[model samples]
Target: MAFRRYLKPRVVPQEVEQIVDALPHHNVGSQGYDPWGLNLDTAKISFTAVRWLYEHYFRVEAHGLENVPADGRLLLIGNHSGQLPMDGVMAAYAIATNPHGPRLPRTMVERWFPTVPFLGNFINQVGGVVGDPKNCGKMLEREEAIIVFPEGIRGSGKPYRLRYQLQRFGHGFMHLAMEHRTPIVPMGIVGCEETMPSVTNIKPLARMLGVPYFPLAPLVPLPAKVHICFGEPMHFPDDARDEGEVERRVERVKDAIRDLIDQGLAKRRGKF
Candidate 1:
């Protein structure tokens, strides 16, 4: 009991503990774990560790968080960059700390992530789920908020020259939104592109590692000030049929994200 007390305070400071404890956890079992593998204790520790990066290091500025619904299933779609998943981390932090309604949004991670030993379980404990449609559907059915990067590796592995220019978005998110009748909150993330700009990708290395792409970038992300703007919630009719209709809906969300990105870029004073 003494050891537990010592470990908890050291790993999770009182301030960080309060911040995490304030988050609305839904469907959590008596053991502090949800069906999707979210462990409340694990989440508290992870949040405490990342709080420094989100607050002082990156100095993330979030706007339009009021637009995110205080309750109900939500889809937070955004552009991906930084040669890593830091953009998703910052966005999730912003939403989790939002004064209006603090909630831990589940982030959809790449399939390759689960193939890595230990990393997969660590991710799941911190509220990350494999980017599978079936899993996402189940979460939505339970009225959970999810963060999705439709650009996938294409955006994250893009060269520095293509930074801020969103890559092609997959239509799967649109299809899910339409089917679930969930509100889509378009998010624009800036500064992450410069955090660890990739000059090129080594396909051979990526193939050997069995990952999407191996980026030629810094080992650690530079502390680039990040800006995350959440746009007004967008809704699509559930009656959509045909691929073209879904594509059109996806395009609309992309446009909204693009506009928000432009705004964030304009508002940015410096990269670091």
Candidate 2:
């Protein structure tokens, strides 16, 4: 759905509220994380927000969560869908409230997000840091679980007609996993693309409105049921040191996610 508003942009809290309203509702004050030696409360809020989104806004049916390790610096690489970042939110929610227990996963967010008043505060409070190489390395060194969508913006912004094809992922995440000897866990998120069938992009309009990007969808409020599937953890040999090997492993993980997305899509389709 195309959202064109001509109202004057409000300031601070109001602006934040407007942004939040434009997307899904979340519980912003519940979970947190410790990164860069800074004990930020934003992580907890982010966790809570995601949990609230699953509990209230979206009907999420998660499977194969037993595949996630209970602890360590694990990398979760997944397919990014939806015009917005709701797919990430749904995955975060599944991890936090796994039937096994409460475990918070820290995510790397874009640097630009935190500069937008309350939105920035909210992101930081939820343990989301700038997607800088230095910060990502630091988090890995600390043995914290990290979630990355290596496709950058492409996976999240693909045209509706091209849903499910894995985008070209940056090698940073694979490099980090090899360096830290962390396992790469693959996650597949379904239904978000159907929620908002964003088929086109209006970049100039987005810039004029001071937003990152604007999407055109067939539905205003997406009613698609969301599903998240976690694949078996894939481990890299601690002594493995070849760059080509790393790339191959990353592709394997990507392939697994694609399969899961297909499975999820089929499962949801069968139910109807």
Candidate 3:
């Protein structure tokens, strides 16, 4: 009994076979039928795997999902961490594996993300778009839920000592929200900072290689329970367009996320 208790959870063979069986459905996007290059079948399969990690490994529990509207132009802004961008994966997973049904969130990634050969191609198949104003506006128009990390590369690659400490969020998302009049939902993801701890950023080497941040973390991430809390959707009137006004609204979102993060952190039993 003790040995069984310590054994890793069994990987369901049926689910794995189901995902493998659907590979043929991936034909939909191989020809670029969708501008975003998203293959719904592929996404479903990918989420199946991600859901396994979320359920058994991280044991992620997403709160306040109802706060997100069922249908509308939505922007999900959040804190990013886990040098591997697993925080983003977990956040995406939280939305994708909703109790009702699977709903993959359209995530915006750095431009350099798609330049990494096979990794880049996989990202495209699973609906990770390059971060840019044009791409964002288009996605919002499609009424898709987009997950944006305003902290960008900084949030993902910050030093281990500074984990959970938010960095400055750029003004792009703020401007996008106001322009499209889309509701912005702030999400705070806890436990990622502890999962993939970064020792330091190799700034010079990262820059030399044209990467945003080259930080060192364990070869495999540690198991950490993740909590994703979604704040109520915040509406920004179309009237606010000035730079100063935009900055203030951006701060409001950041403040909202910070508060949510604190709330999530307070609930941890063993900081797991």
Which is the leading candidate under TM-score? Answer: 1
Candidate 1's TM-score reads: 0.96
C-alpha RMSD of each candidate structure in angstroms:
1.7, 8.4, 6.8
Whole-structure CA lDDT of model 2: 0.69
**Which residue pairs in candidate 1 collide?**
none
Which lDDT value does model 3 have at 123?
A: 85
CA displacement after TM-score superposition, residue 132 of candidate 2 (Å): 1.8
Q: Give the clash count for model 3.
A: 0
- Model 1: lowest-lDDT 10 consecutive positions: 1-10
lDDT per residue as tens, model 1, 1-272: 35434666678888888887888877898888899999877777788868989999999999999999878999999999988899998999999989889888999999989889989988998999999999999999999999999999989889999989989999889888988999999999999999999989999999999999999999999999999999999999888778988888899999999999999999999889
Q: Estimate each model's TM-score.
A: 0.96, 0.78, 0.86
**Ordering by TM-score:** 1, 3, 2
Put down candidate 3 lDDT per residue, 1-272, tens digits, no spaces: 23322331343245644443333232244553357777554555566678778999999889988787766678999998888778888887776545543455778998898888777867877778889889989878877778899988888888889988999899999888988989998999999998889899888999899898878878788899888899999999878757898889899999999999997897777656
